[model samples]
Target: MSGETVITRFAPSPTGRLHLGHAASAIRAHDYARERGGRFVLRIEDIDGTRSRPEFVAGILEDLAWLGLRWDLLVFQSERLAKYQAALETLKARGLVYPCFCTRAEIAASASAPQGDAAPVYPGICRDLTVEEVTARAHLAHCWRLDMAKAVAITGALAWHDAIAGAVVADPLAQGDVVLARKDAPASYHLAVTLDDAAQGVTDVVRGVDLFAATDVHRVLQALLGLPVPSYHHHPLVVDAAGRRLAKRDGALSLAEMREGGEDGATLAARVRGGDRLATSW
Candidate 1:
């Protein structure tokens, strides 16, 4: 990392408008890059065709620009679907990923421990499906999942560094055979973001702490795809009056509303970056 130009990114999904939580993440990454004479990339993670909207994308740009943050480069995950597919193909070639035939209801009902964003840790039901079993279910739609146990055996023990948590050992199994590809989407978030970070030469990953656990899965993907792993800095998420994490579903105030309401973007950004909860109050 010595003498290497620091590169950090604010990869936001365009499913909704940028909120104060989004601003905190952007400011953290923006300031981290700018303070060290490095490049800051603004990546739009809109791979989910169903939720992502052009209006939200436009609003994201407007909000960031209003914050006075200039990105050195811009990237859209939707445009890089081919690259992600190629990576998934590479993993497929290595026998790393497999097709999962389980449905949402079956998974939810069977899974005892859930890991991320309400997604239950997969119980590996389809992990050892026989060739005939696969053929039997061939007519059904399916998604791709990593063969976690085999992947770990091939990669051996894995580890990475975090700016906040210090040295960390990766435990990909904790998440269970995570998804690498979806039926509608060519690639999953774990696979796409990890490849993008390496492809863009990102040296530091600054995002909310909610994604900290996802990093374990990302690290494993990095090793499997032979991608460079970057440093991570997971900051606390912005919460509301009830102390719940700010979410678009929760009607967390959007930056667009703030801008229209005449709240100073710079002032709010600074307050959030300073760990001031009052910035989101009112």
Candidate 2:
């Protein structure tokens, strides 16, 4: 890690159009860095080749620029596959990665089940699977899962200095064995995010409060990979009239639709900030 001035990034996946929720994150990240006399970065998370679209990326850049949000450097994750692979290999060599052959149905048939709002906790059926057994059982190229036990042993407790929430700790047992690389996807969100954040030398991470739960997984991965954990600030999410989170799927609330409705950047920014106008300087 640089261990220097603060550096924050606004990373948006180009799978859908930017909405009010996205604007809140972008604005907050930009403001946080600027307030600290630090640098802000723009990263395009276009790893999902199937859903990611060039048009969406273009729109995101245009929207942020309209809001007067700027960054020091712009990056695309699609161009960093080799970096992810190298990290994956390092884990593999250390026996920190295991091949999981459990199909979705098989995982669901396990004795226990996932809790509310969380993806089914991986059963860890493959954690102890031997190298020969794992290779033999696999029909197709299987995914590589993190060895949580080994990881935790290597790094006792995963902790981070958060910006808003203060100190944070993660339990590897709760996170279980997270996927690192998949047959279909090169790198999972947990893997890609940790690697990218460390690589970019990010000092702070700002996002919606809804992601607070997942922060544990990110923290655990950072410790396992010997990466620096950035301070986090999970801000409140913007909601619609119905008190539901605004999302890209809701076309009417999307930035594109708002633009067509004659809402300028200043107006949209005001609406997001509780219908009150920001300083003209913002």
Candidate 3:
């Protein structure tokens, strides 16, 4: 991701209201790029149709603007299905993708796996399936999974310079096989994000440390798609007084709730900047 100017993005899923954590990310992305005379790209990660709301998206934009954090023309992940599909086809042609027909119960039966914020580690039961066999099984309900074995064979010991995490190595074993597409969403986070970052010519990625592990999966996909590798910065996550990471379920810490109690822009800004040192950290 070499360029005369740097480009960064704050891709937020509009599943809930913009809270302190959201403000921190938006401010950091906006300020970092602006500080270096670069571009700040805004991408709405609304692939999850069940939870993504238009009202929430609008409110997010409103909150960011209220904080005086402006971004470039907005891009929505929901609008880029064909691009993701084409990339999926490329992976398939390279024999780096297969269909997995495992239900929640069946996958659970493999092991009582440890959670990493998202679902448990997906067992590679179907990772070695042949394309024809996978195709036949695809007729039934199943999502597409990336063949990490083939992917790692193509790119060995992948590593990148993280702006904050220093040298980051891509761990193939921990990442294992990942889903590219699901029944509900057209594209998974791995596929959609990798395509969007490349398309936007992003020079660096700045997000919470929560996503540090996923970078390995993205790196492998980047190699498979022949896209440029951008520098990453996994900053500290914003946690509450209880030390729990802020989430959508933490409605009490929302900007809207604080605003309802007579907080203005400057007040919100101070709290956000002070709450987690969030602006500069992310």
On TM-score, the leading prediction is 1
Supply candidate 1's per-residue lDDT for 43. Answer: 98
> How big is the positional error of residue 2 in model 2, measured in Å on the Cα after superposition?
12
Query: Judged by lDDT against the true structure, how good is candidate 3?
Result: 0.81
Comparing 1 and 3 on lDDT, the stronger one? 1
Model 3 regions more than 4 Å off = 1-3, 112-118, 130-136, 274-282
Candidate 2 residue-wise lDDT, 1-282, digit = tens: 464788889999998878777888898898888998999999999988788999999999988887778899899999999999999998988988888878877777783855664567788887887768876887866899988778878878767666677777665678778898977778988889889989999988988898786788787777767788788888877776666677645432677766777778876666555644232211
Off by over 4 Å in 1: 113-117, 280-282
Residue 256 alpha-carbon offset, candidate 2, angstroms: 0.7
Better of 1 and 2 by TM-score: 1
Error of 1 at 27 (Å): 0.4
The candidate maximizing lDDT is 1
Stretches of candidate 2 off by over 4 Å are: 1-3, 250-252, 274-282
| TM-score of candidate 2 to 2 decimals | 0.89
Q: Relative to the true structure, how large is the alpha-carbon lDDT of every model? A: 0.89, 0.80, 0.81
Report the poorest 10 consecutive residues by lDDT, candidate 1: 273-282
